[model samples]
Target: MFSRFLVFLLFSCRSLAFEDTYVIGAGDTIQISVYGEKELSIDSLNINSSGKFEYPYLGELSALNKTPEQLKAEITQGLLGDYIISPKVRVSVVEFRNVYVNGEVKKPGGYEYQPGLTVDKAIALAGGFTDRASRSKVYIAQNGSDDNKNKVKLSEKVLPGDIIVIEQSFF
Candidate 1:
């Protein structure tokens, strides 16, 4: 029984680990900068539905399935090897994909996700919960691989593209 409990604890901790990298998604805005290359810096470039961006000097580049760091490295290499010498590149996400919040909230709709958003914060952004909201039972549907599916009873951390459903309180 003790060994079983230990195993459960380990698994629980592992499941709570947040993903270190953000997958480029549609509607996200990215900022690309090349050190000392003011003409090449692009700010607030929207990621199209195809996850591609029209980067300066680089033409079109696919950002989907790539992390910000990875994208930065790729852009740097492309510029240095082909265009500029010793290009220093940096990439940052200015906006994330919208997340949907529905059921029992005062305003049920899509909300923009900020860094480190929690379920409670999301509810507040939707103008708080209605009187009939079941605060104890909140459901979240995350978009990603099958292994990412979670049916959290009361999760604080909420990711982009997550669908949050608040049931009606029976009381």
Candidate 2:
């Protein structure tokens, strides 16, 4: 039993290692830094509706479909190739847009996506399960994708826009 429990724990930790990299999206605020160039540390970069951002030196750059790291690399490459030499860039996400969590939770609303957040944690953040909430029957609707609407059971990690539904327990 001890060995089985240990195996389960290891598997759980490994499965939680999904990439949480921020993909530049509209309404997302990002912080971009250029190593050794204090003047280049720009904050509050909002991706436009066309998924682009404008910097004074870098001009307009695409932010959509690019991770924070990827965006940094692209900026560094662009700057180094055309203007600066050997640029070092770092990108960080200062704000997440939002994620919705509703149904059966005590407070049921939206919450920001933080590191190491699980289904149980999100539910707890919404004031926890109500007396009529069936914890065991918790369901997650990921991205509202109908093709991927299959239910997930015994899973902890829930993604953004995942609607957690707690069924009413029949007595």
Candidate 3:
């Protein structure tokens, strides 16, 4: 019964953290299309590990934490003056970041990130916890230089590029 409640809470946090428009992050590939502009349409434009993309006209643009629509608006704004008038731009994610799960997990490796990913969902992707895994001692470690690691509930929302560490139980 308690485990079931945890699952419910996990999904709730997942939905809240990841809604319709997912925030773009580093290592994500985005496809951009500008209506009627052949030169502006780009495919498989990968955001570098530093969260930047070298786009046409706009040069290098930051792609960290901005929604696709927000990126589209920025691109359109950049193309206005000398290039296009009222550029109808669209940005779509070609691929998302990969999340890693290590220690005490069955698989213990990196997995592709989906829209609504939670700690439990990531653990499940990693083939669930091992026999010695501690259910209440899991943590989410930010893989970036920022390093915001902390103990987390199974219900905690896991972001792309996050590292879910399932510590081992003593007993």
Best by TM-score: 3
What TM-score does candidate 2 get on C-alpha atoms? 0.75
lDDT for each of the candidates?
0.80, 0.71, 0.84
TM-score head-to-head 1 vs 3, winner: 3
lDDT of 1 by residue, 43-149 (tens): 77888778876777778899876778889888988898678979988888888888788889999999998867888889989999999989887878785333555
What residue pairs are clashing in model 2? none
Error of 2 at 167 (Å): 3.0
How high is each candidate's TM-score? 0.79, 0.75, 0.80
Q: Where does candidate 3 stray beyond 4 Å?
A: 1-22, 143-146
- Give the candidates in order of TM-score, highest first: 3, 1, 2
**Which scores greater on lDDT, model 2 or model 3?**
3
lDDT-sorted candidate list, best first: 3, 1, 2
lDDT of 3 at 135: 99
Q: lDDT score, residue 144, model 2?
A: 45
Clashes of each: 0, 0, 0
Q: Write the per-residue lDDT of candidate 3 for residues 1-171, one digit (tens) a residue.
A: 999999999988875555346888778888989889888899778887688767877788887889887888889889997898678988888788899999999898989888767999999999999999999898888764336878999988877888888889999
> In angstroms, what RMSD does candidate 3 have relative to the true structure?
6.6
Question: What tens digits encode model 2's per-residue C-alpha lDDT throughout 22-41?
Answer: 46565567889888887877
Query: CA lDDT of 61 in candidate 2?
Result: 83
